[model samples]
Each structure stands twice: as structure tokens, then as C-alpha cells.
Target: MSIVLIDSGLGGLTVLHEALQELPHERYLFFADNGNVPYGTKPKETVRSCILSAVQELVTEETKALLIACNTATSIAIADLRRLYSIPVIGMEPAVKPAVELNRNTGKRSLVMATPLALKETKYHDLVNRLGDTEHIDSQPMPGLVTLAEELEFDGPRVQAYLQETIGDRDWQEYGTAVLGCTHFSFFRTAFAKFLPPHIELIDGNRGTVRRLQELIRGREEAPDSAAAAGPVVEFRHSGSDPAYRERMEQALDWYRRDRERAGRPRA
Candidate 1:
């Protein structure tokens, strides 16, 4: 059986990249609903409906697990998905607790960067309250970074402009860590580093989600018996019939590979 990873656009590709490295034996089906891109800007009801429809269309009988890789969709639609799908459904959330812990460890402030919808979600507020004081936790809405990541223009002038505008000239030295609350933002970790001070750490939910999926897959005790077992494979699909979709995805994969190689890290 394959695993399904759903997102609004290229954001989920970041999650898929991690999954490919850590769960090399598993087959992945990445569904990008680019027709309704930027779920973070949509209304809660609209995002939920779109996510449900995407799941219904993408999931197959062979599907063993579903991972919602968008923070906006997960915050609003994850419960509905769990109720509807019998398979294990994993949802991506901001790494607020982890970032806050980093702050405590370093005796510096924690910052949480997310889309407007995620920043306003009750779950996010509760997470902040549980992990740290509201005054100490800095939550900012970064609605444009997702679009930059989708365009695969990381570490460029456009990205620098956007980060400068979004982050302003705040005393970044005061912050010890920044939590990337959106999967899309995870793709541009290096760009974010450029805008922040060197001491500030960056954390995201991509690796955590991959680990969670691995744990669930192991618990199921399922073995690969299908044709896909011959090798690791990733299937990409998008709601919009964009002719450049395949080309862009290939480019993204290449970038992912280069990043790993430059870091001198083997496949996780």
C-alpha cells in the first residue's frame, strides 16, 4: 500500500523530500491542489471542503496512511479526515513547543512564523499557552513566504525582499529560535537564516511528521508486496492542469538532492 501526502501546492513537496530520505522503502503519492492554492488565505470552511475533496480523489484502496502537509488545512480539516478515513492520518502543526524549549535552553526569545489562519487558530494559541508565556512568544504571520517557496525561488533577491518586509528591522538578536509553522516555509530554511541572526535556530514540523509516519507504519507491521516494492517511488499529481507542473517538480527534487549533498548528509 502507498502513502498519500496532500498539500495546497509545492509545500507538501518539502515533506515528501524528508519522507523520501527517511522512508525509502515506502511508495509516496503526492497530491497538490494547486487549483485552490494558498489554503492559508481561504476561509476555514472552504479549506476543509477542498481538503476533503482532494483526499477523496487521491486516496486509493492501497493507501495505508494519509499525511496532511499543510498547516492551514491540518488545523481545520484534520479532525474530519480522521473521522472519515480508517487509515492513520497525520497532520502537520507548528513546532511551537520545540521552539519554546530552545528559547528556554538558550535564555532567549522564541518566534513562531506562520500563515494568518494558523496564527489565529485556537490550537496555536493553546500550544503557545502550554509551552510558554504569551508575552515571551513572538508569533508573526508570514503569508508571502509560501508563494515564494511555491515558485522555487529560495535564497534570491525576491526572497530577501519579502523576508525584509515581513521581518522588518526587529532586534533579531533577542530571539533564539524561529518555528516554521508552515510546510512551505520549510523549503526556504536557508533564506530565513539569511534574514535572522546567526544564533537564532530554525525548527519545522517536516522531520517530526516523517518520524510520526514511520512510527505508525512500523506499528501496522505491513510489508511491501506490490510492484512498487521494487524501488522507492514518488508519484506527483496536481488539481490544476499546469503544463509546467512536472518540470517544476523535477527542479524541486534536484534542489532537494543538492541541499542534502551539500550538507554532507546521507539519506535519513
Candidate 2:
């Protein structure tokens, strides 16, 4: 059985990339709803519908688990999807809990950078409220970053300029942690590191999400229906008919691979 990862666009590749490192032998089916890209800025109902439609298209008897890798989609449709599916349905959330913990006693706040719609969702708010660190948590809408990532604009003058315009004015010293609430934002880690204060650390939920997936997969490893491939394989699909999206996904994966290698962390 294949593990399914769904997102509106290329953002979920970040999570998929992480999974590749840890679950190198697992089969993966990555479904990108490229036809309805940028779920972040869309209406809640519209985004939820798009996510459900994509999930419906991807989930099958051969699917072992489902991961909603987009923060916006997770915020809007994860609960409904979980109710409808018996598979291990995992969803992404901002790494707010860890970020808050990191900032504790440091007199520094944790900044959450995500899409506007995600930040507006009650799920996001309730997460923050439940943490009971409202005073030390701040959120910024980064819809433009999603667009840039979809366009494969990782780091360049345009990306730098956009980052500067969006967050340059902030008092970086007041923030000890920056939670990448959107998966797309992970692609811009280089740009953010160059722009944000050196003291500010970046955090994301990809690792945690992948850990949850590993747990689910482990639980089913001995099941009678469990299937294993000769090696890890990733099948990329999208809602759009364009073949270019497949190439784009490959390119993004290559970029991530090269980036990790440069950081002395080669793929498993």
C-alpha cells in the first residue's frame, strides 16, 4: 500500500521530502491539486471542497494512510476528511507548541508565518488559545510566499525583496522563534535566514507530521494487507491535466535534495 500525501500545490513536497528521508522504503503517492492552487487565500468552504475533492480522487484501497500536508487545507477540511476515512488520516498544524516552548523565559515571542486563510481559521486560533500563550504568540499572513513557491521562486532578488517588504520592518530581536505555518514557506528557509535575525530559529511541523505517519505505518506493518515495494517510489499526480506539473514537482524535489546535500544532510 502507498502512503498518500495531498496538498493544493507544491508545498506538500516539503513534507513528502521529509518522509522520503525517514521512510525511504515506503511507497508514496503525492497528489497536488494544482488546478485549484493557492488554497490559502480562498474562502474556507471553497478550500475545504477542493481538499475533499482531491482526497476523494487520491484515496483508495491501495492507500495505507493520508496526510493533509497543507496548513490551509488542514485548517479547513481535516476534521471532515478524518471522519470520512478509516485510514490513518494525519493533518498539519503550525509548530506553535514547540515555538512557544522555545520562547519561554526568553522574553521573546513566537511568530507564526502562514497563509491568511489558515491564520483566520478557528483551528489555528484554538491551537494558540489552548497553548495559553496568546501574549507570546504572533501571526503573519504570507499568502505571497505561497505564490512565489508555486512559481518555483525560492531565492532571488524578487524573493528577497518580497520578504523584506513583508517582514523587514519587524523587530526581529523580539522573536526567538518563527514557525513556518505554511508548508510552502519551508522552501524559503534560505531567504528567511538571510533576512531575519540570526537569533530567530525557524520551526515547522513536517518532522512531527512525519513522525506521526511513521507511527501509523508501524502499527500496520504486520497487518495481513500490508504491502511492501522493492524500494521507495513516489508517484506524483495533480488535479490539472498539464504534464508540466509533474516536471515541476520533480524539479522541486531535486531542488530540495540539492539543498539538503549542501547542508551535509543527504537523502536516506
Candidate 2 residue-wise lDDT, 1-268, digit = tens: 7899999999999999899888877788998999999998888989988988888888999899999999999999989998999999999999999999888888799899999999999999999999998998989998999899989999999999998888888888888999999999988887887888778888889889999999987867632323444556889998887989999999998897787676643111
User: Model 1 off-target regions past 4 Å?
Assistant: 225-230, 264-268
Instruction: State, as a TM-score between 0 and 1, how close model 2 is to the true structure.
Output: 0.95
Check candidate 2 and list the clashing pairs.
none
**Least well predicted 10-residue stretch by lDDT in candidate 1:** 259-268
RMSD of each: 2.2, 2.6
Identify the runs in model 2 with alpha carbons over 4 angstroms from their true place. 222-230, 264-268
Best by lDDT: 2
- Superposed on all Cα atoms, model 2 deviates from the true structure by an RMSD in Å of 2.6
